[model samples]
Target: MNLMYLTFQEDAPLYLGVKNKIEGQISAFEKLGYQVTCSMWQDNRFCFFGADSFQRPLDPAKRLMKQMTSIANEYIGGHPFDVLYLRLDRVSSDMIQICKTARANHVKTIAVEIPNYPYLADYMRNVKYAKTLGTKVKTAAKVAVTAADDRLSGRKLKQYVDAVVLYGNKADSFFGVKAMNGDNGINIDRIEPIPHCADTSKDIAILGVAGTLWWQGYDRILQGMSTYKKSRSDGPALKFVLVGGDKTEMPEFRALVEKLGLSEDVTFCGFKKGKELSDIYKTVDVGASSLGCYRRGLTRCSSLKAREYCAAALPFLYAYDDAKLKEDTPFALRLPNDESPVNMDRVVEFVQHCRKDPSIAKEEREFAEKNYDWKTIMKQVLEFAGASMK
Candidate 1:
């Protein structure tokens, strides 16, 4: 089967997690004898004009519309695809037309790869429910605009798409039941567990990868570490090594570390990849996933970094509620979604426990291999795509 994968960003060097996921999917599809082609937006611009045109100021929205028009026309004119897969963070108006056009042009299957639903209104409600005073004020206006845009896109998607492919349980919680209702007329599909990499580190260490920090809860991590440190002056020595960050972001994060008095405990690995990353993973006993919500109130996330840690045979911790990872997946540790400092303390203890029990580490690696293998995941995706054809 000929398949097309579409996403906004394809830069793997900067966005390691997304790159790995896209490549993994492609690899899996190839193994199943499916031909896959990927198209990505560069510099957040879908279509670029000549250098002269680029030098002058241009309206971004207009440019996007023109690009969308061109892409739509091309697909309409190009070879017929068995499946058209969209890796979308949120639904948009232009996407609705694109999807409609694809189906109109005899595209057999149209599926969306959704990590989680960014329900801006629901998020605003969550913030209010949590009584996070300043947060509500800071995000109110942006939330209003995003919620309006996404809801419209989401509704259109429900009307047009054959299947909504959920990366994790969080997406299911947001849309699964609705999809099943006859009134909704939407199919909800889950991504089969993909295989994880093996642990190659020799020492016990905690690993962290810094991406866009705002929603990642880096500050919470430092606060938790500070709380943990205060609890035990002579606790087991554990290293928290962070990898990835640009020049500007590094200084901001460093300031937070110093402010929390965790200078000695936290080590910034700057940016490393390939062998250096592999070596770092080898030393890590636990992969420190997200500490809190990407959005202040929402607990749903399909974290690619968490998968990477699991692949590395390191037990991972995430402090998000309603993540839907199976209980039998003992490699994953879920912390309470609260502001309590105890969560950090628990993480500290958990890290030490995993260090002491080789069996636990072994279990994590085994689980990753058995569950997250991309080859198996691709088979499931193909099956789902075939179902969509029916």
Candidate 2:
């Protein structure tokens, strides 16, 4: 079988999360004896690759149908793809046309990896950080209009796609259930999690980010750390080493850290990659995960950071109450839904306890190896794909 994988950030070198996911899927599909081609957006153009992939840009400000038609005429000239798989986080009018055009070309199956919430939810959340009224108003209006367009697009895309693949085990009710619903014989696949391994270790907790964008709630970490520091003068010092995200929210995070008086407690390591990232990971005692955002709380998340922490044999501190992880899961410690000072104090205590018991980190790594290995995740994905075909 031949498959075409498409996502927005296909060609970018950054956006580690998107890159890891796409690469994992591609590697897995190849192992399953399928010819997989990836089509991604990069450099204001669409890049299609399979040993000899090429890129072409779409004319901007064109209608959705026209855009799809113009691209499809070129893309589908060689042969029909067996499946058109989209790994996008959200739906858009252009996405609807992309699917429509793929179906029109007799692509046997269409699939999308659905996230916990619409992309608009994330956009609106980020808009809260905008300093200027004009910027906030413009971004908020665009998000609202996009959200409406996505709703319409989703309703249409749901009918066109043969399968909808979700990440976590649980469904997010706030995201609206129309796309996730399997009422129309649409194959729904909830693939297993994938693990990210690192050779490094550290004694301090690390909240790592790449590029600029504050989706992971770094501000709350400082607030929590300040409370932990003030209350636990006698306890061991809890140091938070932040890696990356300087470009995304360097100014805001820097200002917030100063306002909270956490300069002594937290350290910013700028951006680290390759050997530097691995070296730092070795010193890490615990890995920090998201505290969710203001809008959705911590409902259903597929935290790549948490998985990496576990893969590196580090205990993870997560704010979300995950239904998939049983109470006995040794890999993670759950924090309160709120990132309040009181709750963060408990998180600090948990870290201290983990520090004393070094075995917790080893056990966490074991759990990650057993459950989150990419090979395991891909097996499930391929099995679901096979079942869907039947």
Candidate 3:
């Protein structure tokens, strides 16, 4: 089988998660016995990779909309694949035409993955933070158009799109199409577990690694650290080692850290990768997964970081309804799903509880092997996606 995977994600260095995810998923598809091709838009050009990797620049003189239509007509109309997969960003006219062309070219199965469902609220939140009057006005206008386009496109997409690959699916169907329920699945081979020998007698460290900042909910962690500092002067000293989160919001977070007098307790390790990230992981007692997903209008999420934490055989804290992990799960400490600050006392206790169990790392590694691996998750997705289409 041959698969054409499509996404609008960029090849930017800052947010490597999306790039890494696409690469992992493509590998999983190959493992499932499909030859994969990745189609992406980056650096003002349309690029293709995997089976036959290439890049073609778009004409700068023409609007992107016009260029997208031409590209769809020229490429999708000429080439056909057994399956077409999309990491849908938005439901724009260009995307509609792309789907229509792919279907016309006799693509056997077409599935679009909506990573975040009901994402309009996230855009509205962005509108709130717009810096100037003119910027806010432009942003508000764009949001209005996008909302209308999405509503219209959702219905139109059903004609070409056979199924939706959804994460944290709230309904059996989305926009009048059946949903293949799914979550963020990791490539376990790529994520090696941290080989750490826990030392509970010394100070504790917590790690948060993410490219995007606002939604990760590090503020709650900072607040917890602040309260931890003030209330328990004798409490075991805590350190938060953060990687990435260099977006526009970093300055505000820095100010908050200073305002709360948590300079000594927190260390900002901005934008780390490869060995640098691995070295940081070895020092931390526990990992912090998405703590403020509620900010994105999500009560539950299959967070990628949560899976990464498990793959690393690391105990962690999270504040959302996970696809896996129960409230009683020993390796994980679940927090309330809201805007409240995390209680540092609870965090400290969770660390101690994890240290007491020698089998925690083994248990976590087992969990990742069984539940979070890409091959297992992708097989389930393929069962519903490709087979169901036939």
Candidate 4:
């Protein structure tokens, strides 16, 4: 099968989620003996467009549309693709054109990874096309419910797509998509939880926090930890380690820690990659997924960090109510609500429990390997893209 993958951004050195998803799928397709061509708006030269020297609201839509149309016309003109796999927002005129052209060429399949909500400008664009286009657009229900509030609008979007692949039972009804129950007949070969391995073993009970702490309730976790310190005095010294590239929000976080007299207990290790990040994960006794309340319907979808923590086999503490810490996940614990001051005690208790039972850490790694590994998810995605085992 010849597959063409699409995205909105230009390629950059940093590994973003959309890029990672595309790369994972491409790797799976190649492993299955498929020829994959990834065409994006920009190459490695420019990480992002419209950031420099461009006026406010610089629209790359026109350029992107031209580029996509040209690529489809040139590469897929005479030689039709077996599948035009799109991981794009619907609003892109380029995406709409690509789908229209792909269907016109009688391509066997056209699949999309739907956006969380259909109201975003990009999503609205895609929803508009899906309404008219007779092609099948695959999406996740966990995503659809984020932006869509109106029942009629959600149903209208679903009608255009052929199938909906839901992440969990809760998402199925919300988005009105067909439930594959995370087992959509797709083969997942490399699904395994990762184990946290530290480079040098340390005595302190290190708490590793990953992802955008500012965007996802990092303040709540920090505040909770501060409150927990006031109540407890005797235990292995607990240190907080935050990992991720974005550091714009670090100053405020640092200020809070200092105010709480936690300067010595906290460490910020800027952007890490590959084995470095994994090694850091190993040092920590517990992973923090301090997601706050699902304001405007945000936390309904599955979390990548939660999965990664499980993969590393590090017990994690999350803040959301609906967030499920899978039964197999040994070290994983969910807090009632990280937003309020009340949950601080619970956070401290959960951390203390993991410290006593180190075996739970081993269980978390085992569970991650079994379910949340990207290898397994990619395999399922490939089958959905119509790859045959033969």
Candidate 5:
């Protein structure tokens, strides 16, 4: 089967999620003995035009449709495809017509990739809930606006596609279709988890945090570490490493660490990528995954980082409350609730155990290789796509 993959919005060179996912799937399908061709929009003038500037409402939609239609008409006029896979946020009515035309010609399957869903009003409600739970609502309205925009964009794209390749089970249920999951399949086969490189020399117990600092449970980790340090002064010095830093938001976190007298202990490593990141992971004894419960319904969605953590064989502490995940994932130390802080004693005890029993780390790594590896996950994706394995 000839598969044509389309990604119009995420046209970046390095950090484009949609492009990377599609590329991963394409490579997997090829290995499974299927023909795949990716048709992506590369805007040479995007940098010149400014990313946000070009993302303005109707004007860009019209321009994009015209460009997409012209290309689709010229390239696909005579050629026929079995599957037309689209990773579009929002498409013009004209673009829908083009897809319909393709479906009429030879495209038997049309799958749209749904990466995320945002419920703006629900998020606002969540902000209020967070406030009730004694958290600040600094950017509630802004978060709501962004969430609403994504929801509307996703709905608009769904109207034109035949089926959706959902990134999560929650999205699959939301779309009310037989959705294929892609989270497991869309990474480079041998790509190690966060803090990529292994550094065995560091004696200090390294705890790596990769995601947003202000996110749920992150402060918990910091608080727990502070408590642990205060309780046990004689133990080995534990270094708390923060990766993937948004410099603008670092001040509040730094202040919190200072207030707790953890300045000497906590080190913000800024952003490290490729082998450097892998090495950081190796250096760290333990990696902290998300510890927040799904405040929004979106938590039902599996985290890409969680999968990466599992892949890297890093024993993680997740705050996921889904029953599906609880069923049989041995790679994570799942927390019970989002708001309830993790027990500092338990964390300290676990760390001590890990230090004493190196076999615990070995077991976690083995679990990752068996279950969370991209090769294992993508095999399921290809089978769902009807690509035959050789």
Candidate 6:
């Protein structure tokens, strides 16, 4: 069987997690005995991996959407793939046309994955990513042209797409197709569990890891820490270690830290991987998942960070609704789904409780194995797509 996997992310550091995930999904397909070809757009060219290796240069003069639709039509018309899987770049008319092309070419099992269903706000929020006057103006101009483009495009999804893969969502149908819902899974065998290292005698270390736009609602953490610092001088010291976030959006956070006098307590370790990341994980007492999802107009989600934490057997904290994890889940501490400050005292108690609980490691690892493994999750996705699963 031959599978074609398409990712909309460029080959860049900012998209490293998404790239790694694509690799994991392809690896799962191979393990399941399928010949896989992966495609990515980078350096103004379409880069395809596996038995089909080629680079198709994108026209620079025409707009991006036009180029992608033409490329999808030309390529799918010539290729034979048993399954055509696309990681949608939000909703766009180009994507609708791309799916239409694949179906018209008699391609079997065409499916698209939308990371967020009501993602228009998040998509429009990209305009705030500009750090300079030039980029700001450019992004602003692009937003004006694009804000209305995706609205009607969503309705066309059901016409050609066989399945819409949704993660950690309870929705039965989306875009007029039955959704293939699952957690944001990890390559469990590849991701070694972070050894449990909860030492609460001196200070408890809480870790947060994310890429691109990590909205953990750390402002609430800062507020809690500030209150904790003012209220008590020495309740088992708490330290926050944040990993992977853009510096362009760090100013306000930095200023908040300064204002709260927590500059010395929070440590930022830009980007880490391999052994360096492993070493940091060894020192972490607990991990942090998305705390400010409500701010993004999200009430529930399947967090990749939470998945990584569970795979690492790291006990963690989260506020919003997790796809598989419940508020009563023993291995995790759940907070309120609001913008209020996280209570530092309660956090300390939670850390102490986690450290004392002997079953934390076992429960966390078991939970990860049960729900967050890529092979199992992808098999279900493949089955839902009407593929002849082995």
lDDT of 5 by residue, 161-189 (tens): 56655553344433344566555433535
lDDT-wise, the better of 2 and 4 is 2
lDDT of 4 by residue, 173-262 (tens): 323544333321111233333443342223344454444454366666667667767776763455778775345556777788888888
Q: How many residue pairs clash in each candidate?
A: 8, 13, 1, 18, 11, 0
What lDDT tens digits, residue by residue, belong to model 6 across residues 341-376? 888787788778777776878888888888887888
lDDT of 3 by residue, 138-212 (tens): 999989988898888777888888778777536577788888667787888777788755666678898998887
TM-score top scorer? 3
Q: Model 4 Cα RMSD, Å? A: 9.2
Q: Judged by TM-score relative to the true structure, which candidate is superior, 1 or 3?
A: 3
* Model 5, position 341: C-alpha lDDT score: 54
TM-score of 4: 0.69
Q: In candidate 2, which residue ranges exceed 4 Å CA deviation? A: 10-14, 57-73, 76-78, 123-141, 167-169, 172-203, 210-213, 246-248, 294-298, 342-345, 355-358, 385-390
Predict model 3's lDDT versus the native. 0.81
For this target, which candidate reaches the highest lDDT against the unseen true structure? 3
Ranking by TM-score: 3, 6, 2, 1, 5, 4
TM-score for each model: 0.75, 0.80, 0.94, 0.69, 0.69, 0.91
- The TM-score obtained by model 1 is 0.75
Look at candidate 6 and tell me the lDDT of residue 80.
84
The order by descending lDDT is 3, 6, 2, 1, 5, 4
Per-prediction CA RMSD (Å): 7.3, 5.9, 2.1, 9.2, 6.9, 2.8
